[model samples]
Target: MFKLTLMPQNLEVHLPANSSLTELEFELHGQESISFGCRSGACGACVIEVMSGAEALGARAPCERNFLASLGFDGEQFRLACQCRLAGNAVVSAVAAPR
Candidate 1:
């Protein structure tokens, strides 16, 4: 299992390894820890800062990579929660809405 910690709120969620982000999404539903829009990579509403254990997340898809790049975010720590899956424990913080 893996743990995902949402900062500020410090919400801790546990899930199986290689789990898709749906688990995290479900947990955050209706909460401001991270705001989700399209549930796909196109929207930046669910952006997050991977404070630690970035390896827990899978590689960025081409779509996600392009979107983040367009937003001027070039670091591995920046991610869209809607586009990420966790394979290990991770600590992340919700990013302010870009829109």
Candidate 2:
């Protein structure tokens, strides 16, 4: 099992290694507000900052990479939550919605 820590709110969700971010988000839906649009990584709505265990998440998909590049984000710090699969324990900080 993998422990996902959502920061700012500090909500933690335990999930299987095979679980997708979409599934995790849905599971925690009412507990917290997470910004997300395309579950396929085509949108940048689900980006998060990895606070710990960065190596535990899956690789960035092509769409995520493109979006990240467009935003000039550091590859090591940002991850598209929708594109990342849980592998082990991870602590991530949620990004606030645009004003």
Candidate 3:
């Protein structure tokens, strides 16, 4: 199993290995803060700041890397929630991208 924390909101969620963050969002749908657009990882709307447990997240996909880079975000702590699948456990905070 894996643990996930949605910071600021201080929400905690437990998920089995190989679970996608998208499922979490769906479970918490209508919350406004974790909103996502373009589930394919093409848009930055789902980006989140990883507060810890970086190693637990699966490898960053190519599309995710390219999109973040295009947005001038090079830090490993930043990731698109839509592109991430928990491999172990992670703590992250939802962040809205600049318009």
Candidate 4:
């Protein structure tokens, strides 16, 4: 199982390994702060900062790399929720671009 924490809001959810963050966001769509756009990973609307366990997000997709690079956000701490699938537990914060 994987433990996911949404920060500031401090919402925590448990999911199995290989679970999709997009699916989580979809299920919690009305939460307001946990936003999503272009679920295919082409947009940065769902960008998040990994507060801990960044490795749990698995590998970065090509679209995610391109978008993050274009935004000058070259680091492991930042990730697009749409492109992430949890491999372990992780704590993250919803953040805007240039993070």
Worst 10 residues of 2 by lDDT: 90-99
True-structure RMSD for candidate 3 = 1.7
Best-performing candidate as measured by TM-score: 3
Tens-digit lDDT track of model 3 for 31-81: 644768888888788888899988787778777877887887778888888
Q: Over 4 Å off in model 1, which ranges?
A: none
Those runs of model 4 whose alpha carbons end farther than 4 Å from true positions after fitting are none
lDDT of 1 by residue, 2-43 (tens): 888889898988888877665665766666567777887887
Clashes of 2: 0
Q: How far out, in Å, is residue 32 in model 1?
A: 3.1
RMSD of each: 2.0, 2.1, 1.7, 1.8
Residue 5 Cα positional deviation in candidate 4, in Å, after optimal superposition? 0.4
- Clashes within 3 Å, all models in order: 0, 0, 0, 0
Which runs in model 3 stand beyond 4 Å of their true positions?
none
lDDT of 1: 0.80
TM-score of 3: 0.87
- Kindly list the per-residue Cα lDDT of model 2 for residues 19-93, writing each as its tens digit: 887776567866774577887776678878899988888777666777877866646778888878889998998
Q: lDDT value for candidate 4? A: 0.81
**Candidates sorted by lDDT, descending order?**
4, 3, 1, 2
* TM-score between candidate 4 and the true structure: 0.85
lDDT of each: 0.80, 0.78, 0.81, 0.81
